[model samples]
Structure formats: structure tokens, C-alpha cells
Target: NKRVNHKRVYRLMKQLKLKAIIRRKTKRYKPFTPEVTAQNILNRSFNETKKNKKWLTDVTEFKLKNGNKVYLSAIYDLGSKTILSYELSSSNNNQLVFNTLDKAVKKVKNTKGIIFHSDRGFQYTSRSFKAKLKEHKMIQSMSRVGCCIDNGPMESVWGMMKSEIYKGNKNFSFINYELALIELAKYIHFYNTNRITLKMAKSIA
Candidate 1:
């Protein structure tokens, strides 16, 4: 239909422009003011002292409405600001967290002395989790009980996923969760390759 009527395309574009102009002139939409504040941890210390010296992991739970919940655990490589691995499951347990960690470890060539940082959540403090880190020759690190800055990057990613992609949607099934995961993968690809980071200004040249 668009191909058959070239003038129709121009008319639609004009209508869209008029609508946009009217909306802007009328001030119908208000700017968003963020109520929740995230601390700036990476101020000038964003660079990792060594590769894999600090890795961040975070867990976010989404309710499935029938009272079931899906837990998502992710491991992020702080050095590269990249998501190394993530796992989604109906249960928030050691198994899910371990699977995420193992998948991340598999991607790295050397696992020795990697610092895995997370909140003092039970999943991260469990004996099973500690044992796995020891087995992989990685060190365990934890943030203070109430500090979000300690794991800011991971939390930021989760916030973006929840607000931008899954806003107003709740009680998702496995299939819906899979679709969100695929969308997140696409967003992450755009973030890493197409979106320029302010920190990379000097390096880009």
C-alpha cells in the first residue's frame, strides 16, 4: 500500500508532523523526574585495575501472578561493562545462580582470581555458592547491606530491562520471559556496539 501511493506517504508524514507540533505546543506530556536515585560509584575509578579483578552479579525477581516467581541472575564483567552470562528460572535458588556463574566462567579463558561481587543475599552467601567460587579459584566479594552503589551497573541494567521493555507487564509465563530475554539481547547488542559510552571518548579516537 505504501509503495502504490507515494503521495500518501507524504500526506501521512505531514499529518504526523502536525500532530507532533500540536502535542509539543499543547504541553500534554510532562518530563520524567526520577524519584529513585542511584549512586555514582564509577566516578573516576571506572577502570578495572586488572581484567576480571571485579565481576558483578545481581538477582531480580519477577512475579508470575499465580504466585510463582521467575528469578533472573546475571554476571557482568566490570572491566568491559558487558553481561557475561544470565539465567532465568521459576525458582530463585542456588542452582539458578550457580548455572549463571558457570556459564560466565566458561566464557573466560582463565578463571583464577576473579572477584565475584554481589549483595549479601542468601543466594550469594550460601555454602553452595561459596564452594563453587572456591572450586573455580575465584574470590567472593559482597556489598554493604544497604549500598546499591557497590553493584550499580548490574542494577542499572535490570532497571532498564524492567522499565523500558517489561513496563506494566507482570506475571509472565516462560514464553513471555523468553521473548523479553531475546529483546534484552538485542538491546545489549545495540548498547555495546552502537551506543557510545561517555567513558570511551578518548579510546574511540
Candidate 2:
């Protein structure tokens, strides 16, 4: 293992014009088609007093060992910076977003005028989803096109989740779908009940 020192190896590689290659995983499916675009009502105002006053939702994709993908749809409470609900599925379809929305609505106490924020993904823009929001009397807010900063809070949640649970985990890629599900479930529980954030100065739960 000590055949070559790290500094010497770096110098040799530089001399040979060699560099480490980082392979990125590519999406297996086509990107979602946009149906409707909503204004960024959130406007990066991530603070809220009431727990259910403002919520954010988004879907993230993860690759499995067999080249298949899994999608996680989550609802985050802006007030507490807590995960209200989440759904994992093999497909990132309209149903995935619907299910997650339904779960979060049920878990929360009230939602008469809650502002539900998200990016303009196809699932969120679909007529069915808009109807669902109207049915619950929830206001739908979306990030402006090509403006990731509008959904910064939700994006931060996903980033921290991945960093804590998957990144640097050597065997993560070798795990099967079911195991991946279990791992995520456990982490979500810990995140909601135990993990602390400086903003809250306490655990979200």
C-alpha cells in the first residue's frame, strides 16, 4: 500500500498529464415535461411562524445497483424545517407527488390556506395536482424557471440528507432497492426526531 507516497504519485500523474476521472450517474428516464408555470410566491422567504402556514415539496432521484432509479417525494415544513411526509417510489409519476401531498395533509393539523411551494415539475403542474390543491384549499407556489435559489430550502434538505446517509458510504451503490428504502426510512425518522439544526437550535421534531 505504501509503494508510492501520495505527493510523489500526484507529481508523477501530473508529469504524465493524467488526472482522476469522476464518473457521474446519468438519468435513466427523460426529464419531466412542464405543464404549467407558477410564480415564485415563496420568493426565498423561508421563514414562517405557524407550522403548516408554508410547506415545500420536491422530488429527487437516486440510482440503484441494477441501473433502475427510485424517486423520493417529500414535504418540508418551512416553519420548523422538518419533514412532514415523504414517499418513495420506483417511478416519479404524478401519483408519487399526489401520494406525498395526501400524506402530508393528513399528518398536519390544518391546511386551509397553507402555501404549498415547489418547482414547476410536471407532476406539480399537472391538472390533477392543481385540482388536488384546490380541493384542499392550499395555495400552490412554484420556483421560477431556471431559478434553483427559489427552492433553496427544499434543496438544502435533500443535500443534507444525501450527504449524511449516502455520500462517502462505500457500499451504497451495491445496495438493493429494498435496502435503500429501509436506509432512507431510518434516516428520515432520525432527521425528523433527532437531528438538530442551528436555525432551530433544536431537533425539528
Candidate 3:
């Protein structure tokens, strides 16, 4: 039998020296409709020939004042791995995505064929958001249905920000939101210029 028969494995005796534990539950969701028409444009990886060639966008939510939620959407340049544009909104609506995309496009003009990759969240899939992408002459790409790892970079970013910035906050207030945004901006600056990315082999945006 490929089993460890150590008594400690089943022992519940030591409450005095117990280790802190975390339990996680899995949730399931219906799959998004596949968008095969869109090119596997990001090539299922993060590489681009030029600085503004490809962009990845994602949305994350945070608990805000009085149980309301604040959503953060951002576009990241695939080449430099820097955040191109980001915005915070009370809801993760299509308007939030459109505004972030508009800001990113304005910030980096000449993105005629850049790819914008994101999960098939409702906001990203909405008519307005797609229209904005089309208006900017941007290509749209979505992570495959039910595959979160396809957007691993953004997931890691969220985890890091939550652990470092929002882990201890018991309640969210307007001032807290302001402070969190400022802190996130600072983190972005440091992450882009100063922080070393092992995957990139050096410090870079």
C-alpha cells in the first residue's frame, strides 16, 4: 500500500501545538460559449514583438464600503509586462471595461492590431465592450471556457495584492478604497520598474 501509516497523520490529539489550517471549497460554473472566430491571438502565451503589440486585460473585485464591491480592471502590455491602464468602478460593468480599454488605447496609440485577451466575463463579452475593441481596431481573445490558468498572471497579481494590501482590513470604507487605490498604484510602479521578474530574467516593466 502506498500509504504513510504514521500515527500523526490521523492524530487529532495535540490541540495545544496545532498548526493553523486553511480549508478551501471548489465552485463550478457553466462554460462560456466558445469564440473560435477570435484568433488564439495571444498565442496562449505572453510574448509580443513590440511594446504595444499585445495586451491582456482582467477584472478583479474587492469588498467595499457597506458590503458593496469595487471592481478593478486593467490592461497589461505583453512586451514590457507593465500595466498600460487601469480603473476602479463600483460595478464590473461593460462601461468599466470600455473605459479601461479606451484609456489604454489612448495611452498607447497605434495599436492597430493589438490583441486584448481576457476571460469570458459578462463585461468582456458584452456588446459595448466588443464594439469598443472593434472601434480601436483591436483583436479580441478569450481564455478557453473554465480554464482559469489561461489567465494565471492576472490571478497571481490579484493574490499578491490581496495578501499584501487587503488581508487585514475588516471593513471597507471610502477612505480605505482611496488608500487601497493609491497603494495599488505604487505597487504597479514598483512592479513595473523595480521588481525583478524571474520569468523575464531581469527587472523590467
Top-lDDT candidate index: 2
Question: Where does candidate 1 clash, by residue pair?
Answer: none
Candidate 2: residue 157 Cα off by (Å)? 0.7
- Specify the highest-TM-score model's number: 2
Per-residue error at 109 for model 3, in Å? 2.1
Error of 1 at 137 (Å): 1.2
Model 1 TM-score? Answer: 0.65
Flag clash pairs in model 3: 80-205
Cα TM-score per model: 0.65, 0.83, 0.75
**Model 3 TM-score, 2 decimals:** 0.75
On the 0 to 100 scale, the lDDT of residue 172 in model 2 is 61
Error of 3 at 148 (Å): 1.4
For model 1, give the 10-residue run with minimal summed lDDT. Answer: 35-44
Quick one: RMSD of model 2? 5.7
Least accurate 10 contiguous residues by lDDT in model 2: 196-205
